[model samples]
Target chain A: MTAIQISVFLENKSGRLAEVTHALAKGGINIRALSLAETIDYGVLRLIVDKPKEAKTALAEAGFTVTETEVIAVAMPDRPGGLAGIVDLVTRHGLNIEYLYAFVGQRGENAVVIFRVDNAEEAITALQEGGAHVLSAAELSAI
Target chain B: MHETTPCWNREMEFMEEGHLRPLQSERLRDVVARVYERVPYYKEKLDAAGVSPEDIRGIEDIVRLPFTSKDDLRDTYPFGLFAVPMEQVVRVHASSGTTGRPTVVGYTRRDVQMWAEVMARTFAAGGTHIGDVVQNSYGYGLFTGGLGAHYGAELIGASVVPTSGGQTKRQVQILQDFGSTVLCCTPSYALVIGETGREMGVDFAGLPLRVGFFGAEPWSQSMRQEIEASLHVDALDIYGLSEMIGPGVSFECLEKGGLHINEDHFFPEVINPKTGDPVPDGELGELVFTSLTKEALPVLRYRSRDLTRIVTEPCGCGRSLRRMERVTGRTDEMLIVRGVNVFPSQVEEVLMRIEETTPNYLLVLDRKPRGMDEMEVQVEVSERTFSDEMSKLETLSERIGGEIEETLGLRVSVRLVEPRSLERSTGKAKRVMDRRDLGR
Candidate 1:
């Protein structure tokens, strides 16, 4: 299964993050993984959500600037190197990982790992062509 | 030999009576010619009026030159008014950009000395002397009030506590522990300090403060009286503009009649803001200044939008240079709310008169759902008024609304907010908020 990543820009101010989070919650979108990068004026709220398309639509309708990027979601053993195996494969394929985080589905049988790479499309193509089980949005939503 | 007592005020007050007038007159003529020769803006303006720099022979010939207004300063931007090279300028300060872009002004080392001297004289007028511990609450950096007061206190050999504005309770503690004798800040800040001191049960009456130099905004005599009674000190108003020089341009002595214009450094004239003609004594007009001794950025008849009457009457303080009444209102500060001309000073005056309300207030101009303009005056009620019955609160609000309607010729909704509901300004309080069409 792959990790669905979404990007949102937020102005820096008190309670601004709360406003966005509350808006997304009202839309019934659950965030699996999140990372926030910021500068003086604004921050980019990166999220791996259960429903990427619906979450992007909800946030855009709520007046937030959102961007989506394809990220490699490699299933791990839920133990050590569970994810390092994928890192080793990507490194062997001459790919660089920009950022990565992990999330576990409700089933608890598998670990869903998220990856931000310098070239996301190539990483996804290579991982999929390499016969890795890259989960689609439908499979993730069902999980 | 003992050190001589620096008569910082002498150059501004008594210099014309001695040899400073001739020196100023000669420099004034030379400066006019130099500006005509070097600065294109001054040259074009003066030339268009068919006036020659050679025509200006003395101080009396100043009327021939055109008046310089804030618009001129704005048009010039950072260095439009500089007569000398930029490298010679020792420091620069600017007016707050509330209306538009801020007007920039510069000074040389000698100009800074004059500023310090002006402030020294102002401090001395309020009875400041050696060993007196002065606490300065004016906001520092880029703004002239704090540094100006600091230099004056330093020049007078007074022990100064450089506690810039804010931290109200700590300010009271410093007043108690440090035994600060003289306080320098805006009149509004002094009132806030008094209110805060009362809340903390500090014996404000037991404080060592004997005098307060309050200015940088228009404050009424009623306010002065209230501040004096609360803080247990005599209140003196100091007046100056950044375009002319900072706080040391003029100050009120013990006389309390008006602010004495420091004629040695600044020459003040009251001219009609619209007509540019001199107004008679006691008539309210815009203040115009000519920096007789300012070296780096000398302005000739620069119009300060501040509206006040100039008084040449002999003051008991013995400084004969002229006095200007406390500013009534500035031309730029007049607010046209819902077709009624309203000045924030009038609202402040009304609030001060009401014993139940706190001096802090905000004028909120909002719009209705129907797109019609409406105004709300959110005045803070004192703690004593807070526990009053609902009926009493309603009556108080009605009374304030009626007075505002009467004074401003416009109806307004008055809301009596809780005590300390309105935010306290560490520097100048922005009293008006125009939210109409703001989002658009």
Candidate 2:
């Protein structure tokens, strides 16, 4: 129904993203997906990792400002119109998606998509009712 | 006065030590009695010290009097320490204080006259005279510097150009077009204008700008040489605080060695900063002053906190008043940037208002290439305020910069460093990194 996401504060400078990767590498955690949103002053490194709690600790101990939030992760058929179908279903359900990122993993011909929506419970209910395989925190980690 | 010496008040400037001591003693005793009788703050301080006006028979009994610190001024606030009634006070000036409030000083008509007289000496000590066009560049409004030098220049029958501060190119143009013979501003600002004139292809050596009075912040002897060469004029140092009637406290004469204190009005003493006891002549200690002739806001044995030595030797200028070595440093952590007082705690106060910022901060201070003060405050981003958004962080930095400017009256660029990026030592963390070389 919901997945854990780790967010880190990064100054918009060289080696900042490298530092985040370095921290995760040192902590022996795998970053499943990440989206970098930036401005002139600083950036926010949104990370979906195999172990969110450990990644947060590693980044925090490495002198990074880190936060943990809940997100919606779903799997769809790996086809041309798969993303369009799921997005249209959510839009028809009147659910707002704040941001979304995707990772290509062929788990029986399906792609994983992580979403940050306004209401995670409602988004999960609507997606499940629409026959979408909504992934849980455990299922996202297992992937 | 001797023909070799040029002084504003011939009688007082050349008065022998024997005559000046008694005059100071009489004035000190009178002011002590008047403050005790009129000001409640002084009355409480004197009574708490178990000393009264009768105990202060002359200048010799000044030690028995309690010392007034800036904290005492803060406690009394805006006008609680004024000795005279508001009806008799003619002017007021203020300087930024450590706390949110500013230190205010009020002056009576006669007190204003005394400030002008001492400032006149400050001008004449450097050989400025009538018919000289004095370009007064000190800030004019609430600060005493601009108006203090203005009144003195006019009192000496000299034409004044109240240029105030800023606009370096315009200042250079005025120096060229107005034919100003005397210059007044901070040492750093003088360097700024000198460099601007050079860049604008204005030759300073060809101009008639003879001398400049620089103060409001400390500069090194090397800086004096730099300014003299750049501006092509004899640069002298003028010292004062708003509480002491601004810029005429003590001044460097043509000798350009130590500054001569106008002891007739302000009595100067050097004391061990920790013990508050008087330091011997020629030994460095904190400089303290007692206002002898001031009426509106008379202060006795006010701790100045400036570190310098007292030299009682007769100067080649033939002035008998004791001179102080140029101030070496301060006993406190106050930073004087572009003639304004900036405290690290002041910045901390501003940063604390924003919940996202931690209490730990570092202030990096430097001088621009053209010679204006610049600062950057490095603050750590907190975990609670972290978000998956960039505009929120940008807004945080801008809000910090705005609040700091409003509080300290200084334009400081805010730098949001990463958490744990700023050093945390086992002992006291160093909060300030002063990069400007004032020969320190």
Tell how far residue B319 is off in model 1, in angstroms: 1.2
User: Lowest summed-lDDT stretch of 10 residues in model 1 chain B?
Assistant: B1-10
TM-score of each: 0.59, 0.59
Q: Could you give me the TM-score of model 2 versus the true structure?
A: 0.59
What are the per-residue Cα lDDT tens digits for candidate 1 across A22-58?
Answer: 8789889887777776545345577877788889889
Clashing residue pairs, candidate 2?
none
Candidate 1: residue B49 lDDT (0-100): 79
Residue B132 CA displacement from its true place in model 2, Å: 0.5
Off by over 4 Å in 1: A1-143, B1-24, B333-440
lDDT of 2 by residue, B1-440 (tens): 47778789888888888999999999999989999999998899899999989888878899899999988888888999998889999998888654668889999999898899999999999888999999999999988999999998899989999999999889999999999999999998998998999899999999999999999887667678889999999999999977778899999999998999989889988887777889889876789999988988999888988878898677888888889988755768677888766767667657657889876789999988888888989898887776565556778889999999998888888888777777762234688999998883
TM-score of chain A of 2: 0.95
- What does DockQ come to for candidate 1? 0.01
In the order shown, the candidates' DockQ scores are 0.01, 0.39
